[model samples]
Target: PKEDRERRGVTDGLLRLSVGIEDCDDLIADLRQAIERSARR
Candidate 1:
């Protein structure tokens, strides 16, 4: 597990989210948060 979870240094900022029956505003907020966090890296 450690070997498989090691960082590959590929900062693609890929966001995979599932908006299943949730509010659109909430989904956008989540994506915004993810992008903001990634940008801080």
Candidate 2:
């Protein structure tokens, strides 16, 4: 299962989030913060 997941290009840092009823500005801010945090590592 792990190998299959890896083969599909899903790495350890992958994040699967739910965007349920969130506003655009809020989502954008969240995404920017997430990307920034990932870039730091």
- Each model's lDDT comes to 0.72, 0.91
Q: In candidate 1, which residue pairs clash?
A: none
Evaluate model 1: give its lDDT. Answer: 0.72
Question: Residue by residue across 1-41, what tens digits does model 1's lDDT show?
Answer: 54444465334554445569988898899889988998999
| TM-score of each model, in listed order | 0.55, 0.57
Q: What would the per-residue lDDT of candidate 2 be over residues 1-41, giving only the tens digit for each residue?
A: 88998999888879788898989999999999988998999
Q: Pick the candidate with the highest lDDT.
A: 2
Models, CA RMSD each = 5.6, 2.8
The number of the candidate with the highest TM-score is 2
